[model samples]
Target: MTLLAPQPFRPKSAQLLSGLMFCWVLLSSAACQEDGASVNCTANPEQCGIDVEAVPARLYVDPPFGLGFGCVLMGCDEAKILTLENRGGGQLAITSVRFKEGSSEDFSFALYNDEEDPADEALEHPTIEKPLKIKDSRTKALSVTYKPTDGIADEAVLIIDAHDASLPYQDSVLTTVEVPLRSRVLGSVAFVPSTDTINFGYVAPDETGQAILTLENTSENDAVLTLAALNLTDENDAFAFTFPENPHANPGDVIEVALSFTPSEYQDYEGQLTVATNDTAQPLIAVDLRGTAFSEPGIRITPSVGQGIDFGAVRFGETDVWELQLYNAGGAPLTVTPSISALGDTDPNVFHMGSTSGEALAEIAPLESTVLSVYATPAGGGAQEGVLQLETTDPNNPLITVTLAVFGNAPMAEYSIEDIDFGNVVMGWQSDVVEVTIGNTGTGDLTIFSYDFEIGSSPQIMLGSAPDLPVKISPDDDPISFAFFLNGQSLGPANATFLLQTDAIDYSTARLDLTGQVVSCIDGCPVANGTPSCEAGYCAIGSCAEGYHDTNVAFADGCECQEERNGDDIGGNCSDKRDLGNLGDDCSDHAHSVTVTGNLHDAEDTDLYYVKMEDAGSVICDTFGDSFRAKVELISAPPGLALCVNIRASGSGCGGYTDYYDPSYCGQNSYSSNGSWSSDDDKEVVAWVVWKPDATPICTNYQIKFRADD
Candidate 1:
């Protein structure tokens, strides 16, 4: 519910009916209120009609805004009527009706068919000749409209020329009436918003998120705003909108629109909400909307793979336990449970998960890890084999299995880091080193008797920093170490595995897998011109050898789009200006001598060129395609040579083009006198711009051809 503003007391309807029972008011011996076709002749000869909101200039020191049209939004218009009632014994002649001199054209006066009815059929602006005759006790009405051309407070006098037969005429507007009109223009639409864009970061599938778009009517009291439609645009079926129940609104009435986004897919979603209304200034408004949904979590178990884990050197009829780490590597939370798998045809309850470690895990956040333990109690074996199973919520890796083995009084060997990733490596640059610590967590001594290396299609993975072979690691003692890095020898994916052999009898071999990519220059740069290259894994323009410069610091389009030129191109700044030595020297030397053509390249690129007219008496320089986009100006002519330039060019940031005629109001198309200049000081050199004067430069080819008369 909208609350109404308090209005000042105006017992205009019946001021006498208040406080007192009643006043025996009498007007010409008639009842308190009555207005017949024939009014009393005892009153003033002429009075303002009831429909007109005006005060006589003689009565009010500073009269209120005529017709009280108040503030009206730009691009919108409001109209009122001025009525004159004749209460005299004779006819009233209205000679003319118009606004005062110097009054804004925004205000206009026209004749009307009826004062109270504005229906198309009843409203007419037909011209009326001077001295429109009004019989006694009759009323005449004139319509006035206020449609501001600019936003500002304005005041003007509305003059009504008249002559009453009952009064003798005098000099100087003998019978004249002036009504002062005052109004402050408004610049915005009736509907105002709380926010222009709505973004719902991320939501899971089947879940919904909501945002509110508040729209308020901030126009005048009578400027009623009506909502025609409210909903999301096409292709946005996932988002829904609930609008205010009542679609009509007056001043101060607010509408809080609720918009909800429920994405069903696992990718980014985009949409827009359109508010269609009856506001003449802005008929439709659009708000940007964005969100994402449905992300999965990836699970990785450290120190594990097929035959990758070992509970080594356990004595017969004895138990030993090993710890395993579970890591969530993707975007969402993960849930997992650890258990042991039975091999074929064997009562394989010998190797099992620890009691505390078998409990199901839940909600593991991304990049975070949890721990689990497994026990190996060998009965009788040279080496007992078993497999560990991990069930997880990762859609890609639901069931992860790692082969395990137990031996009697044997050495156990393991590598500290199992997986290595060198994110990105330049084609010929070496990657960062990753160290792998080898250690033994068994009862007996661990001996690395030998080692071997294997590689994928691309052998860019270099293994180094290894300790001497035949290294021995006593029980619970420090282990051997090694290092590896991506050598970036070629452009392709690099993969390799290094294996180490130990004295442990079961699962005794240990291996470390390495992976990375050898990328080429410009591999990650987005679309654009120029020879792009990557040095330290970063994209950039390689060289200016092609006569193309990356003047624009954006890597998306590489180098070419920013600045490209052939041999005919000139420099961008005044320092690099092209000097066209001598542009003829005579008045009427109409030969087009210097012809220069160049591209604007971009909005910020300004091409400056100079010419020598030292001996010329007069000159005329003009650029073709006279538009605000590629505006041309003669900065200054040679001191002794009088030059004429096109004065139509302007450097304005108000908008993109010069609407010299103001077709629809693009912006402030203001121009200074610099576009047109003349000088005869006989200076050495003067230059003109292909132009850099302002930001509205057109990004296309511009040409100039002119003659200097001698």
Candidate 2:
């Protein structure tokens, strides 16, 4: 009565077997069924009609489980292929292929429809919204790339979503797959240069010249450079190189190297400069160097013919010429050309130059010579100088100059005797002859016509002897002599001049001064108040008498004073007596006795008297004075005469002391009137006054009394 609902569809064989088994099992268990439970197919599977099965989805990657891009340099990119296969026998749908969580920024993923050329079928965008379909036993490709900005190891994974069409009945189901990616970034180094050669131009020997070489680094990292060795073909080690110490350069950095060249000889020089670095492409770099050395010329000049050429002195309007030689003492030829055109004053009249061939240029070969003539004509009288300049081709000295000097003089004449002096001449006498030397002290000759006294010259001055008239004296000649005399009758100084006529242009008539002094007869005599007599143009004087002296230096005063007895005043009232000891004189008279009165001014005063006794008698001589101490000395008379004296001290005011000639005549009777007269000659007696040096002036009167004993 209850019909069973249709069971799930199943295979025919399985359904038939399952139906038979179910009928038998139902007969066996019929008694166990309850009366109210009819055939219930919902709860019991044996009552079902058929059975159905569902399909499952599966995912497989072509590279199994991972993908890698290998190691690469920084700033470079690498790519790899990732494949997903549908192995579950159904249409596979990929919804998206993207980077998973915890993935790095250096990794990327993209989907491609083409299996053979995955790069050609890359998706425009990295993420995909439309699902991709893959049939059973088919595969899909994904493009994965790794790029880094820094040097580091990187790893990432790609996530894929795959769906199965057979499992469409189910919801929220997917096949998830991951493909791992990894990579490593590395640093690169390189080196480059701006140039590879250096050239040093012409350089002098032993002098250094330099050039520069530049180097650069083209790598993305830092690098170091070092110089190894610099080789040169120099015997004297003339080439050199200067490099930095352990140079470290960064990216895009440039360095400079200085290379110098110095040659020892005059020749061409060549060398190489090498630089080493840590570049992989090029480890060593070489630079070529070249230079040249040359020699220079020198110049020297000297006098050709002699030490120097002198033009001497010439007239103002005259011209003088001189010659000088130019010699080349160098290894090269010396070329000379006149530079007269450059002179500010190139007057041909003042200085003129001429060559042997009259050429403007002069060339002297090595060890050869040439002549240079110079003429100078002064414009006026005096010293003049000029210069001659020449230009040459020598490197050391390019210009040569010579100096010329000349003197211009006018006609002139001079005398060696400017003045003449006849010192002193006595009246009525001729002076000693004085010679005057006349010479030509000028540059020209002196022609003398005549010589005479000047108009104002005294008539007593005359030229006694001279050179003949019309005499010529050349320059620098020995002077000639001329004698002159001075005779006058007057007593005074006299001056005159002697005029000489000459042919000199400057001095037509030269005058020479003559000076002299005339002295009178009294002045010419040697003794004062002496009788002067003219003898042979000189005055002679007689000798002076005794007891008289001339104290005045002037000739006008004759014998002026009587001789004093001592340096101090011997006060005596004696007359001026100049008589010699003649028989007729006052002191020599033997007929009478002599008596005199005098005064003693000081102790040093002395008085002298003369006496003569005809017949021997008592000769008594006595001296009396007041406030005076007198000392008397009596000289012994002749052989036929005898004398005596008496000595005594009167008082404290005055005293008298006598000195006898002999002790036998000392007594009072010593002068007895007993001898006869032998000769009528006078005898001398002296008296002295005694006083102290400090005594005041005192005038003491004294008297000498003389009497013949009768």
Candidate 3:
């Protein structure tokens, strides 16, 4: 083995000067060579040692740790580039790049001169055949490619030898540079929902309800999510969603969406809520949104007075009508069926449902009401009770019952007069008649038993005419009349009680008070001093005393002024008949005959006589003719009596009989035998006539005898 020595060190300027001195010494070396035969040899090997300094190469990696391929899905490729720069003034040569001990298969790397190629296959523990050299301040790229077969966290280390040379004789050890590489392999982009389905249990048709659905981003990194569409599968459009405007979320972030359900009908409804998103695993998510729409009906009764229907105090055979209100207080339409019936002894026909047909159905909308009419007509008197049943489609209460009641009574007789006043009457005179009317105001018929003055009453007041007793009066019919008269006999004030008895229970006895005063006549007759006499509540007088007449029919005015008659004998008797020449006397008594004389002035100037008969009887008349043709007429005879006979001749004739006669009552009393006469030129002839009776009695008759004059 040869011993190695270091080379001699010399300054550049000193080396040049040494070279010149060597040349000069060679030129003078021949002349001084004979004298320098004896030159000394003092050059020592230890003193001529050479000094040599060694510096190691430095490698600077832009990233001390390898670049990170953040995250990649399985079977997908991602890459990152790392730079190696030579910071020292020496060549940085990479001999081999190798993974660390615990490196992953999913993490790999590659080296390139100018650019990075991510698609290139990565090498593990790879040795460079030719050393890669890098200059100072220059960079070299190492591309890290990650292709994950499975989802897991992985790391690797890429070691670079900067001092390694291509020749085996060169130095192989230098500064070691390490670049750490890391990669995370993700499975896939996923969207996880908080709930898979939303259920809105029950909702009303008129109302709306809502629910919330959360969409969470299950991806490991931030992701841009897109809400492509939101759809409702309900045909009725009852379900919907309130979509978010920006549908972006980071890892573990959540996006909330609102789901609403609205119903329109009264039946059950079903629907689905669909959401479209950008998630790779689940692009379109369908959330089952279920809801049911239901209806509840309610019944209510509103009566006229109380909670129940009541027809109070109705008369028998009369009807009373009322109204009841039904309300729908729920969210849906209500159907109602109304019926009415008597509960106990009352008749079924008494209670009736009006405004609706038999068993008719009624529909009421939500929060609305309907009115039903009811009528109560009692057939008999007394208390009546009934029930009104209403059936509806309400879930809570299907059947509703209401009580009804009514009271009825018999017809009542109402009197128009509470009292009667005859006013003042003179002595020996009578007062005017006062009338009292009785009306049946109740629902039934009323019968009057009797109407008369009370027993043991004063003679001053008496009944004018007896009214027919046991008479029937119908409800709302014309009233019955009763009259009373006052006789001016008593002194001072005279009082009498007129009592009415009826069949009606409510009006068993009705009494009216008659009051009058006996007054002394002012202008009538002389007063009796010794023995004062009063007759019929009036002062005794022989005839009508003076100017005062009983105009008011009060006895106080004894002699009333003669009322103007106008040819109508309203209150006149036979003795006071008017128009004596042209008209005959009106008979006051059917049993008595009156003689009336009249002259026939012309053919049209005939006389007429009237007889009001109380019993069936014949009327006899005789006419004395003067100069004109006379005609005798007996009209309006009794049913069996013949009509009046008329005789006509040049002068006079008196033996004319009725052609048709059937006198069966008195066999010998023939109508022909009663009349026979002859006509005379200048003498007066007397004509006689008689009327017979019929089966039934007659009340009125008329007779006339006249002459036809030229």
Candidate 4:
């Protein structure tokens, strides 16, 4: 083919075109050369344009250019097959294609064609495959699988240092493709609750409740869910909150939390719970806790019946004590107020045992009870009754009352003389009479329908006159009478006693007995039978004739008068002495010098009567040695005198006795010693005595003579 085939010179336009073309070709070829080799080019600007800027080698990915999730596999997961197209204007030569050091284990790739397979050592330099050529505008596919560590970034860059033999080393291009670190996240997040809410109703200050949250795994993989926050609130200051457990959540995990609320100074309340977690878009979980709050329950009282007390069947002014009990059964403490009131016509102040109205009585804790006392005192004397009412706020059981009873005054009996005495009555004397007044001075009625006169071995005595038999006395009425009679025999100075009885009185009967007596002789004088004791040893049987020895002597002795002396019985010594004043031997002779003496002290006074009677000794003598005369003397006289006597003579066989007369002048005349005897003649002195009694002697000058002596 050495034939110089077309040396034929052409036109100048073609040559000029060739010269310009040659110059253009040279510059254009220089622009097209990678290292030093020529490249086919055209002189047209559009065809042979020179671009100095490095254009990144790109891929037209037909298959999975973007990262995708992987199916779950053994230890972890993997992601997919991918393809790339060489769409740049130049042929590409990939020298090394690999991931960075830390990212190398995250991916693996397989060439789409056998010729595109990079040698194993290609990853040593620039960390990729060995150098490989790809024609311009060609497609190169790969199967790329990748797996990323959990909780790490999911993307990485695959770097390829491409070199062309026609270009310099610095002129070679480096290509990188962003490949997502793929993972198979096969789980979703959900919220779970062990319980919705906890209601602690009517609780004390120290109480607690527990709530649990669970993070459930709906997929095949474990999930990490985080808790952001937790909240609790209440309506009043009555409640507070606390958390005793952690707020973390994991897939298929449950967390138990304790919530506590303490009520402070409040009655009722409501509370809520809020929990926030990272698993859901709206992470807050709300729970409502509710219950009724109570303080303590108290007892309210209202009396059962009338307020004014009427103690039925009870006497007035009677007092009774009652009781009331109350309880607090609620969860809190209760304060109680106890009051006393009388219902109906009764006065409030009439019946009272407890504190006043609105007085706080006691404070009771939960399940505690207390008792109160109420006193009811009536006002009047008849049957008094009323009701005791208690007031409180308890709606169910409000009021209460208690019945009262009181017994008042009863009647008692009274009598006049508690003691009586019967003197010198004979033994078995049955006609001894004494009167006792029975009266009922009290407000109650008394009855004395029968009369009973009880006596010791005496006949049944009549309380009234003889034949009337018995008497009935009434309250506040007059006195009653009774009599006992002697048994017609010798019932004398010794064995004398009796008692009067009553049927209505319950106590012992009224009785009388002798408590005193007198002896036959006095002042060292010999006494005989039926003889009165000598009055100062100066009394005898006969009368004291005119001008007798002393004016006190009852009789004259032998008519021989003795000389008189001025001495009187001073100091009561009864001895004759020469020391005598002008005092006369009269009753005034015993008086002191001055009736009103030194200091004028009062003298004890005594009034007495004594009988001096003639005995058998005087009768046998036929002379007047003993006499029957009652001596009237002043022991200690109170400026006066009282004289009276009733004597009975005991004669032998009821016949032999002394005949006596009542003598008028036993001593000096009744007037004085200086005066004459009111009787002048010698009267028949039988047995006689004179007295200054209002009952003068029946015989003014008579004396007794013993018939036994005759």
Candidate 5:
């Protein structure tokens, strides 16, 4: 410092800074040493330098990413600056500078007398005329200044590449600058009750409740918030908002969304709230609310159609009620009105929960249930049908459906034939066959048990089949058919009667009346009803016709027989039937009758008697009177006409009679006489009638005439 060395401006400290000029000394030394002897500095390049080092270059930009600084509110301008410094002990060369659309423009830069200025054309660029000199301890800077195109978001990158001229060949160093975007601020908004789910206890129908929604701004930047809409899904309600700007929220501020639910008679409420904002990061925020608003106490009835209940078959003058329970699951009271409905028609005010005139049911509280009675009455025994429907309003899940059932009765079943007919049966034959068909038109089953008619008993009729039978049949099925056989003897159809009986009870009066007739005939000749033909012995009834006579001989045809017969006749109406005196009508010419009075002893010879006839050969009568031999006061005398008689018991001689006369009734009959005139010859009375001839007789008479013995 004592006087700057004028000797080439060299100082002793300059030798201490020799490392800083290492690159310059190597280049100068190589040229000086290569005059004749080669210093070989370029060959041994690593040993040619004095260890000179270059400072690292650094870049500075106005804003790191070139985001427009505060331009969103103040309308930014291009006031940013970019600089490059020579941190090394060498010069830096800037070969070219490039500019693009939306790039940092309207700017100028100077590097060692090299300058760049704005051009008239957009996206303009100019190559540098000289290398840039970024001296040590001196920084090179480029200035950029312009009015923003519009919003300043149409920004681009600025590239600055530097070359180090101290190296063998210049190497490039690249650095970039960016311009970012900015936004506006309106208000802040957020979900107050951040949770998405809400719960409300049981509420009655037509009841009102409030759902509160709170909003807050958690964003650091101010935001523009707007309440978009309060949307309801699957809801039935007419809603009004009380708070004006509730859904609109502000940043770092709290706002409330007043949710009002006014439900119809019996319903629940559900809705959603959406908030719109200007923040790009978060555009819209959504908040949903769900609550229950109770309705008035009114009957809400629902009827069902059970599968097993058939409506078309109900009884006449009958009513059926399917009770449906309506519950108030809201917080307020409710009212219910019950009614009946058909497909095309509805019955007004038929069923009432409380009052039929006014509101039927009322004051139904929370968690309370009531029954709605729906009456479906059938007017007559005819097929009828319909349904029942109830109308109500609910915000969410409003309409519920059920089925209705109605019914009527069908007609009763009748029969076609009441009685069974057993055509024709034989006699002494049992179990004859009969058939019948029973029909049913009713809805139920018809069971027939042991209902049959019985045939009465006769010698010609024998019942061999049971009169009881049973069968079961449904209405839709064909009529039950019964077939049976009877075996019995039959005179005629009229002679048999069917005794109708059921089970063991005897109801034999149900009978078919009949009569029988049997006639005899011989070779086409009619005989008496009960008599048989003489030779053929054949009899048949229901065959005889017109007048007929009886011929009592073989081959005797009554129509071809003679009309009269000649015979010896008795004077005063002698009948063809013979009559004896005491034998009454059964005697013939070979017939006789006898009466005797006598006293007989066993000690008499055999007697014989001869009959005196009015006609010589035809003896109409033969009998003997008693004879006596006795004296009163004088000596004994012989009998008048020693009467003897013999009796005949049978045959033509005896006239078919059994006589009681004794053997003494024969006259002029001797014990040993065999002559035709002797009493002994005709003394066969004892042999003819009396088996005991040796017995004593007290008196004698011809044919039992009394004879006294003295």
Candidate 6:
């Protein structure tokens, strides 16, 4: 059987359709051709229309790959149209059409008039009043609108029934056709979070980390997204997710969901979070949440808080050093800060102690240790106590303290002055009183049993004032004070002794010797190269002559350091550079100057000098002095021949020349290695004692030493 579609058919299909209709007519004429006489149905259908029950109308549908609304959002409308053609000779009446494919209300059908009925714009269900009518060789549009109500793949069978209305009830000539309808509906809007996956990074045990999941509606402004459900599945029970309270969201609206993760063990944990929303494209949003719980920092001290560092017996004025070990036993880095506690007044007998560990340590890697030194210096006797406190970033042991204990047991009397000299006194002249003090440098009390004085040749010196006959001195008590006087009555040198009898275990007596020259005060001090003055019945070198210093500060030693000025290199300018005579071939064959000790009063005190190298390939010099200052060796060229350039303008701590000096003060031409520049024009290299810019005093007290390297 050949079916001719009323749609836009191909030319070949139309030609084939005309041939089939002609063949059907010929077959009908041949059936009535008895006795060689043909009955034409066009003229008079005598036999063709004689008692015949023929099918007048038939239903035909071009599914065109089945009516389908691929995928659409819920509460949204998507429609498709199908052409129903009447291939029969009579008009086709589609009485009704229904959807039987998934029994889902999402898929529905309606009938609309063809181009012949332009006024039938409104969709109408196929029925007796608005039946889908397709005349012979005509077509009508059967519209199927899929308004998905659920988020699932669905299918529906469009059951269309058509028949000729003129036929009797028994011979209704009914036709039924099924067209497959398919569609998929999803949530009306979607949820976009701040992140698709939440990673808590490295979280330590017993620590909780949190992250936020943001929900945003990406649908039209009028469209709303309703959160249907939310859930989380965690096998380890280490994660907790909090769903947003408000379930409804519109376009441009944002929702936030909180999630927290806390791990009890040092292991990896993972969980899955599912959020159900009204997003047709993706109704369920699954996010992977992961985190790792690592071990925390732990501090272990060698001497625990209870057990302290004890120094058994330490004498006053003596120091004892101890060692402390700090260990980190956890998987993370630990930070430590150490401090010494101040001595408490409750204990009169206390020691002064401090830790070399200044303030804080940046970090200590896992399973590491560092050593700290603490020293205890006793200032009093008896049981001396101190504390060393350490603060660390360890959860288990944040603050750790170690105690220091020492005992002072012996007491020895110590005198402030071993001897007193009232030099050169006049007759009948009374000298100034010299105050003397006596202290105990031991653990116990020192008692002054008695006191005595021994005058040798002349009775010139005597006791001006003395402490009580018997006095007790404790290690912590203030030292007792007394006075001595020098009386000049004779003309000659005199000597005397003042002694204290104490109950000291080692020595029972403390003595102070006194001496003086009993001469005429009018004679004054015989100071060399300096003036003399008499004051307090004694002779003194009051002032020095010009260009001289009282270096020894004595009437006899006279004035020394007879330099013009304090500058080391007196001729310290470019015009008057100090020449450090030529050197020998050997490093120390005959050293012109082995070591020169000098102090740089200030940065401007620059000593510019040059040494002539003799029978030597190169000369290397080093500086040894105070570390605060930097010593610069400037290998200079005479005037501009061997230009001595202050590369870093002196005082610039460390630099190229200092690291390795080169004779090439001017830029090297061949760039042969570095700093070694020798001029055939001159042999003198000036070495300047300049300041290291920052630490000018670093090499202030420097011992400039030089030697021939080759």
Specify the highest-lDDT model's number: 6
RMSD after CA superposition, every candidate: 43.8, 36.1, 38.3, 38.7, 32.1, 35.4
Return the top candidate by TM-score.
6
Cα lDDT of model 1 by residue, 317-390, tens digit? 67898878886655578888777755653237667776434567667775456877777877654567888777
TM-score quality measure for candidate 4:
0.23
Comparison by lDDT, 1 against 3, better one: 1
Give the range where candidate 4 is weakest over 10 consecutive residues by summed lDDT. Answer: 594-603
lDDT of each: 0.57, 0.53, 0.55, 0.39, 0.37, 0.60
Using lDDT as the measure, name the better of candidate 1 and candidate 2. 1
List TM-scores for all candidates, in order: 0.25, 0.26, 0.25, 0.23, 0.24, 0.29
Q: Candidate 5, residues 58-84: lDDT per residue as tens digits?
A: 333333443333322122343444444
| Candidate 6 weakest ten by summed lDDT | 622-631
Off by over 4 Å in 2: 1-417, 421-424, 438-450, 468-481, 489-495, 501-509, 517-519, 523-527, 542-710
Scored by Cα lDDT, where does model 1 land?
0.57
Model 2 global lDDT (CA atoms, 0 to 1): 0.53
Better of 2 and 6 by TM-score: 6
On residues 1-710, what C-alpha lDDT tens digit does candidate 3 reach at each position? 11112112222244544342211111111111122342211121112221111222346566564577765444457867777665433455777777778888887767766544435543333345567777644667777788754334567777766562323526465556667776743454567887776767568886898888888767766343445678887778888788876565545666788888888876655567788876767889887766656556655556433467778867666789887777665657788887777888888888887755347466886555688888888777667899887778988778777788887757688878799888777766888888878888775567787776788666788877655767888776898787788777756778888788886657588888888887766433343211223543444434442322232233333333332232232221223322222212221122222333322111111222323211111144224322223233433333443333332332342333222232431222111211122322221222222334333222223333333221
lDDT (Cα) of model 5 = 0.37
Q: What is the clash count of model 4?
A: 59
User: Once superposed on the true structure, which residue ranges of model 6 sit more than 4 Å away at CA?
Assistant: 1-55, 70-76, 101-104, 115-124, 127-134, 147-154, 183-193, 196-212, 215-229, 233-272, 275-710
Tell me how far the alpha carbon of residue 382 in candidate 6 is from the true structure, in angstroms, after superposition.
49
